[model samples]
Target: MTDYGHDLAFGSFLTPSAGTPEQTVSLAMLCEQVGLDLVTFQDHPYQPGFLDTWTLLSVVAARTERVAVSANVLNLPLRPPAVLARSAASLDLLSGGRVELGLGAGAFWDAIEAMGGQRLTPADAVQALAEAIEIIRRIWDTDTRGGVRVDGDFHRVHGAKRGPAPAHDIGIWLGAYKPRMLQLTGRVADGWLPSLGYLADGDLAAGNLRIDEAAAAAGRSPSAVRRLLNVSGSFTGSGTGPLQGPAARWVDDLTRWALEDGISTFILGTDDPDDLRRFAAEVAPAVRELVAAERTAPVPAAPVPPAPVPAAGPAPLVQSRHAGTGFAVVPTPDDGVRRSSRRVWDEAARPTGPAPDPARRYTRQELVGGQHLIDIHDHLRAELAQVQDLVEQVAAGSLGVGAARSHLNTMTMRQNNWTLGTYCESYCRVVTTHHTIEDQSMLPHLERADPRLAPVVDRLQQEHLVIHEVLEGVDRALVALVSTPTGMDELRAAMDLLTDTLLSHLSYEERELVEPLARLGMH
Candidate 1:
């Protein structure tokens, strides 16, 4: 096994479609909301249909609070390294050090030439990229006393003053495939990014060997360079092919990659919101859990000489550890309070999951499965509070509609009631998407794993529908708030109803399903 011992990370790779600029930004924000570690966009600056990758990255960084942002493989031919370094450093500072650089050799010579960028042969392109990397690093080396200077065949920089260092040690990841480029990645780059689609059978192994050899030859540890793969596949009901199956299949495949091939980062190339959610909520955590288990699993001890039997007196009584005591996942309990007079479902009548067997022992990994559900719900709870706070600000006149609209315009959440409506709508979509995943994928899996959970699953599905209707009510109230002066009261009422229904349902679901999930697993 070639495990590099790096922490695994998951990210999203989105197309910078200028046609739906707002949606692109929204997807990036959703990456952060859904607990993804990074967000990336492809760069094709010559294409008129796509947004400028740098501009989109800046906007995404501004809008998202946690997720790191990067261009999948920025075209170096069109961007000068000295200036690119400064721009990256500036954005990294602004975004609180969440910027990564993914650079590439030039491609599409005709388009590059048309855009006033020099086109070169494959060998020349790789050379140019190496030269660019040197200049970029030199420009960022502000601690050095002298000005940055690099003179090469393709790029030349002399006496360029360097300062304004990045907020963090930004990784320079290269999208490399060819031998020379791969060698360069192993020698200097912090990461190696390659697309899975472009790789054939055994290609990943071969590439890893090459990179490792190059790293060793350059007096560097192979583990110094993190491996990242850009992946795309369908989510089917069963195993169809590699990465083309349910979330369980994804977990298995990615875990294998992490353990055997040393790929520490997996970036899903997708534009569909549902796929993004499933990848984040289902596949990512399970993969992390499994990889962690294997890495930490104890190695078999060498054969030890058996100790001589002592006095065969009374046989030592072996007491098995208590089972129920080890099940540490505690479900969040409902406070039995309601914010609104409106009631969606009769909570008292909800069906309970099958009782746990007192003899069944639970492992730490199994408990994490149940805790994962609560963690996701906690994120939703926090976001809902933010939405409510935004509404309150608007109601109190602390934030005027025009000013809110202008502020939200920068985020690109374009809607009639700019601030409150945009936020509420986003939250509503997240709730809807969460319910959809559970209904379609999670609940069905639970039903199959243990038929006794059928009734509980059925009740949860029903609650999901009721919650959907409540979300629609909130959306309608938002629309009214845009045109009617008396809409604030109605909006508040809708939010109160949503808050009550959502929290109660979430608590009940956790109470019913947490133990079962811990026992049976999320898949």
Candidate 2:
């Protein structure tokens, strides 16, 4: 029950059974107002009683602003990739990128067969699911020219381009239980969405063990694929769900299950309309309280991160930025060179950071399309080299007054012209993405693979916090300098303070991890 985004992942569903526009919107809105992490919708392909998931979600997307809209478990084999990609893209476009795809290979073979679709072998279904994902990603890459194309062993989808990607992160989740499907999930999904009871009978530990094993075989972190548990909205936890109980009690049980699974997201569904109401009114609050409480609590110090694995062959310098959400922190100049930066700040407050124009800042959706993730090796080498030189210079006491003044003058010039990308901007972009990948994706693996790395990782976490505060000070100074436009002295003072602190901090950090870096086969 280690703290692993339990607060962030606790989300539930609003089955489109009885939710009126007002009801669903009201519930979804209220959920976000209280910081409910996400909202999922159940997609029932053959169920006539339920509303079409696509139409219903578009309505929800228009109404809610912040909540992530996700598919509970979209059966992948049932839908063609081209069509599915288009539908998913449309939701992403409408929602501004708050859409997530929760897909499953589907257990309802008879259901599809009844609908006149072919009955799929389990192997075929999984293979089809794999091919579909490839095709869908391609469609996202290109425009809707000839639609989408999927020429695979199982299927060939041609043409299926959709416009306008999602505004925020559109994570893909795979619902898996068995080994093969779970393996596929590990290989292909942003998360492993499990179909399990919170406190089911007998030992479910076997599945957990296998999940970890399969994930390893795939050379992926079990954590790489987030764990999501789908459950009934009302939980009495007598092993029978929607058990008659007060909503608060049910929510508590749900949280308990989430913790057990090391999962934070719970996709809730119920037949009774009142169950949804009860969840929103009485239950959801208790869950959010726990979530908020957990978030505010101090994180346990993680061990030092293991050295990054060296790639055997030449890797792309930056894989399509579309490979993941948003941009990887580049070693590029952190100047406010991107015009959209300053424009954003001026509208809200005087330009504090380079990005003055808060009005035109790129959200995750817009940041997509050709940008790529900088390879971890390429990233570490440059940043480490930049930091190492400064650290050694400061350590040598040979960095005398002349050298200091020279460095300070150059920094001042960059600040004056607003053309210089300061350490502050570089640090912010680097940390925002760095923290996400390391703490969320990388740390877990390091902890398991090399216990030796624990202390180093702990120190890095401390560095992250210190750097964050330093950058905040940088932002404050930058804004003041811009508004008055004569604060070279102000700029000099800020840079001196930042540079001095950075030198001392990074020198110690470099010594601590330089060996690890070499061990990892990185420069």
Candidate 3:
């Protein structure tokens, strides 16, 4: 005898026709009234006709109780991995571990095309998905020490740490059907939610077979991975009795197919509160009673427990006073957790040309968590040293125009690296993620601890602007020449200019901070 449990979860999807916020909450209250196992809300970032799901859920979490809440699926690739993970943890912590993260290798082509974003091939999207998922979990691990540590072809997170792993470990659900993807599910995913097809038009058996094979490869029993699905709208209560009435019959059809396939979760989507209410009131109770009876009557010496149904209980976010986020910024490269990308070592590809290629120069990984800002600071330090050496030599008469030009090329690399890299990664990426951190985590601390150093910070920022202008000008005139081996003349001119301009800024900044820095030279 198999240990049986009748577990049912409910889904809420806001559509163009869905009611207002007040109405949605009213529907939620009724769901709690009906004892919904779990309530999942759909999220579509660019869903024009619907509300931004997270914002809505944030509000819902506060207003509702006794019902678990989450995005039916969150398009994770649309956001920075760290940002999404932090939000996931925050929701889970607040909800007492009731949050579920439903992810997919994004296929929202119209949305991507609208934003002018990188349109990924299927392979690329899956590659990104793998890295993104790892980044999410690494940030979650209780033992994660220091800044986040992850280095892979697609991403590098140097700074990350966040708190209060959800009361319920946030479950990961994959909304995919491909074979390689199913393998990923068996190996890593917490569950699989495949979409149901109508009649002979679709082939569910083939996909399930693929999943079974993948599970074997992943060293797991085929039944170990949780399986679920969305029932097609045409499922009428046509085949069964009152329990098989339009709604019950519809659910029974789904339940039978799911049980045979080792799928236990069924997400029945309906915008009508009444229709869902009927399922809860008329159908769900019957299933639970039957399931409980089966569990109690089981006699097999070795009974496999029925998969625990994902309970749709209490809204995860309601009635919590967590004003500030407990989730830390996911560790990124800037935090010095992971080694930089392999491309970092391939200096042969480093651009010494006039203008840097924005796309090639910066990977999507850097902009995600302020690693770009961190890198800009790093390159600035390196560039400053090179410029300082050239200036000191020139001032001492040990160097002339030829020496100046040679060093100037190195200056150009630094200047351009900062110019293109900073905007592409820092102000553009970091500020975009969490704007207040600039003023909160950084600027205020710099000012409060050392007001006298204010002038130097301003000067450094100003040098950033100057570097940009100079690099752009040099790129226009000398990009092609630097790519090749020779032309010391071109290098001499760039070097002379950068050494003069940048060394001056460094000297000024040093003068402003000399007193403070001298007090604790090594520290």
Candidate 4:
């Protein structure tokens, strides 16, 4: 086995479609919302049907809060190393240190030449890429007291000033396959990125051997280079093939790749939103869990040493002692305040989950799964508060409706809006996505794990439908606000209903499901 001991990362490789720019960016944001680690786009500057990858990366970074962005493999021939270095550094600084560089030697010579890039042979291309990597590294080395200098046949940077280091030590991954490129990757690159479709049987093993050998010869550890693969597959209900069956199948395949092939990062090249959701909510977590178990599994002959026991001590006495429940997670309580007289569902009719057994003990690690659900809900709550604040600012004439609309539109929250309408719409979409994930993935898993919780799960799903309608009502109010301009009361009413339903529903969910999730886990 060739496990590299790298922490597993999941990501999406999206197409920057010019035809549906909004959808593309929305999918990128969804990757972050669903807990993916990275978001990448393929670079094809010569293609008219695609958005410029660099520009799209900038927009995606702005739209998302915490997802690394990169080009799958930027075409190095078309982009100069010196300028690319500065651009990557600037974006890394702007995005709060979430940028990775994926570089590739030139491909599609005819298109590249047509776009004013130099055409070279395969050997020359590899050599040129090496020179570009040198130049790019030199440009980022601000601590070195002198101008960057790299003199090569393909690229020369003579006395070029080097400053503006990236916010973090950005990883330079290479899309390499050939012997020369593999050797170069092992010697210098931080990662090896290859598309699964480009590799045949045994190709990964063979390539790893070459890279490992090269790394050893260059006085470096083979584990220094992280392995990332771009994968594409379909999600089916039954067994089809590798990565083409259910989420469990994908997890099994990915776990094997991680343990045996040392592939730590799996980037799915998909455009379907459902696939993205399943990949994040199901496959990613399972793979991480499985890989972790195996990595920490005890060896056959070498038994692990027992943990040291604490010294015995007398128990402290308390005045008013009572039996305690093992569950420690505290659900957010509903404030029971309403801004509007409207109500979506009967609050008293909500079903309660079965009470947890006081005898059951839960580990801190196990309880974390329940806390994670609360963390996600807290983020939604914060965003909702921001939406309300923006609305109040616009209402008080502190923020211009046109300027707010323009800012949101530039972020691609929605196509059209007035003042805080787009921000509100974005928040609505996030709420909808969270509910959809619960309705489709988490609720089903919970139902299977604990049949006694059926009434609670059913009620949650029903509330999800009601919230969907509330969101649609918000959308309508936004449309009216755009046309009538004096429809702030209607908009405010819609927001009030949303706040009421969403907050109440979230608290009910936490109260009911937290214990079960802690006991049964999120699988």
Candidate 5:
């Protein structure tokens, strides 16, 4: 439950205020300049003080080069589905696929009717939205032989020509929270868009469930539907209020939502330029770093074996150790070399598993299984040292900033701001993956094969989570290294913590698991 396995994205949700239309566009540009991933505007055809969402999006798309532009929730009643589809596709083409569509069921019936739109009941509106979704999809299906055709109650598109595909696969995000709307979103939409301010207590979780269930029922993967949120808060003196705290609070709160609530896209709704800058410059990257760390955190339990064939019943139990066996008893290696300056855990306090029977011996499979753990640990040890070297090299002037940048440009780290950020993220992923394999496959199998190993297995599992936190600390330091003047000291300290935890955890795991694994083969 550490992560929803979705990529984290951040954006600005600026209000389309008619009074300051230029300011709204300027803020959208500012968001791109500050590293925000997206820029969205609200739509309300009946609101006199609001600018037209579509027009504003067009202007924004023209101005910004990288950030995506979207209507937070386009007023669907005022814009026909077919026309909306064409407009979205055209803008997406013009913007080089930097466009996402967020549509909403009609709201404010009185105002809808005043604007020459149909006044549909709540039930009718939901039905209308569903039909609209079908119509839009049909219009975008250029590969189909026939013209677009969807004979629906509300939105029937007959023989409409379908051409001019968007530059990329455009996602249709829905602003929906009610059960029926949530269900519709799961069944058809690419993303679920909701504002945190409008959600009541527990609504976020409940909505996710509804959407997931609907997606499953419709034969779609739940992860295929992206979770997006419209959030608002202020950076005041004290770290209080929902999101009304400093940048650190924003990072923590948003990261928790991604980890626990499965909401990956965070769109901050604010008109203030300073708030926008802070959210982008400070909060966004930190949230990404935290969520990414957690996503690869160790799994708590064993996963179902891949392509597991049905067994007749249960296999006969074998003795733990026998004197003469298939292969030589490979002893667990202990080089007695400690690389870390600080010890993270009390190794003396580690609980012991059942001792192997002296009479029984090990098999070739078991010997290989045990040595595999050591091999993995050795790899992690090497990677950790490299990570430390990278940080120190940058700090000590052995590697100049320009040389670091040049080296990074050849790697995936070039996408990130700082070299440390790229290196730390990659190293953390490797460590997390190693822990994940052991926790999910190795430890569970060992525990099941020998129940007496429970205490040691539990301790190792706990250490995995602790190491995850340490890795996150390193990530936070990496983020700071880009903006803070004296970030090297912080980075070094963070790396030291990681080195302590990781080295200690790896040693403890190898010591405990090697013998058990040698006695019982890994599944």
Candidate 6:
């Protein structure tokens, strides 16, 4: 496999439906809530039913704290390069670098002409897009000494003052599929953004080759051009239809796309909150862990002798036995600081990992396995916060129960009382899957390696059962909350119980496992 070594990223491609603008923005918020990296909306200004993509992006950016915002591919024909540059830069600056520009050549000539935009032939549109890129980049180069000037056939700017520079280096991602656009992307653009629907089954590899060749010809490294895709698929519990199968199929398919196609950024296109949550909480993390394992796998190499430490003046105070080898120091939370009120389990019963042997070191494989656990835990933590937020919204009457329930149903995507129940069910399934893997695979392996770890593993397994009960309790509360008029207290109590049990269990597990996982190894 060709490892581009580019850090993999995931995002969402939301539809900017005018009728459900609030829902669109809420979906973007959900993306941020569940730890997605970016959120984008499609731009089709001529469409009467769609909201203005730029305004929608601005609103989403303002609403979200972490997730980046962008247009799926802004229609360049409608937005002049100078104005588009300023608008993008302004948003990027306002959002504190959480903005990316996805630009496209003009499409649908009749609609473009109707909207008071010039209609260009296909070749001319591509050429114009190239010129627009040059103009946009020149406008954003605030440090350049002279006034910007680019004389092109389609767009020409003469001696225009440079930008109010963006907060960060904004990536110019091109929505490209044709060879010409792909080559142009390699030559100048920072990323290649293409929707899966537009590409044939085998087009990804061939497109990558073209981009790589053009990048080489342009004296730029192929890795410099980030490959980002806008993907859409359904999630079904049974039957195979692309992403309609189980979560395992998604993990496998996405992992292959990363390894073989060199696509580092995947933006899921969906309006459903449940689908978005599943993509973020389950599919994203699993793909990351699998890819990380492969990427960090040990490569065979000849052994080399360590350099002699000079018979120096003083001995080291904190000598690392793994001095020559690079091993990252693992992190942990501070002691006994509770963020919530309720308690589910006693913390004193928790076990700790074995003490360090200073002389003993960790293998790469062991470290990867340990890190994967933490990654999964992080996902759970984020989802828990979202669950709490939803509960509060329901209690406050800010989010109607019916509205919330509608979001929870992936099968129907309609309003119902099972929104909270369905959400809790999906989330509980994720927690169960995590524990099942540890109980069946990881704990057994660790116990086999060192008999002393048996106690810790046993405690962890017991906690898993406790957490499962806590999850069931939350489910029971949801059922009651839906049935009773004054069940807000029940909902809050259920969540608090979950918070206490899950957080404590996760912290305890990480504390006891991080070291052992690194030293003893994981399957």
The digit string of per-residue lDDT tens for model 4 on 400-450 reads 455554455433223334536746765676676567657766888999998
Q: Which candidate is the best by TM-score?
A: 5
lDDT digits (tens) for residues 1-523 of candidate 5: 4245677889988889899888888888999988899999888988999999899999999998999988889889999999988988999999999999899998988998999999898788999999998888777889888888888888888898986688888889999978889999999999999999999878888899899999999999898899999999988645556776666567657866887789989999988989988787667765665565454433222212223324665422121221133334233333445545666667668786665554554544447555655655665677688778777767766554554545455344323337567667767865765565567657888889888999999999988988888888888888777768767778888888887777766666665666677777766
Candidate 3 lDDT over residue span 114-203, tens digit each: 755456778777777788888888777766567677786666787767543556677788877676676677777777776665224334
Residue pairs with clashing backbones, model 6: 405-419
RMSD of 3: 29.6
Q: Candidate 6's residue-wise lDDT over 107-161, tens digit each?
A: 8889989999998988899999999999999999998988888899999999988
The TM-score between candidate 1 and the true structure equals 0.63
Off by over 4 Å in 4: 302-523
Q: For model 2, how many clashes?
A: 42
RMSD of each: 9.9, 18.9, 29.6, 10.3, 10.2, 11.0
What's model 6's lDDT at 335? 48
Count steric clashes of candidate 4: 0
Residue-by-residue lDDT tens digits, candidate 2, 25-144: 566666565455677777777877676776777777788887787777786656777777778887787777778888877667788778766677888888988887787777676544
Each model's TM-score, in the order given? 0.63, 0.49, 0.51, 0.60, 0.64, 0.63
The local lDDT score (0 to 100) that residue 410 gets in candidate 4 is 39
Q: How well does candidate 2 score on lDDT at residue 129?
A: 84
* Candidates ranked by lDDT: 1, 4, 6, 5, 2, 3
Runs in model 3 lying further than 4 Å from the true structure: 1-10, 14-19, 162-164, 197-205, 221-224, 232-245, 291-523
**Cα miss at 350, model 6 (Å)?**
28
Lowest-sum lDDT 10-residue window in model 2: 347-356
Specify the highest-lDDT model's number. Answer: 1
Q: After superposition, how far is residue 150 of candidate 6 from its true place, in Å?
A: 0.7
| lDDT per model vs. reference | 0.83, 0.54, 0.51, 0.83, 0.77, 0.79
Give per-candidate clash totals.
0, 42, 35, 0, 6, 1
Report the CA-based lDDT of candidate 5 relative to the real structure. Answer: 0.77
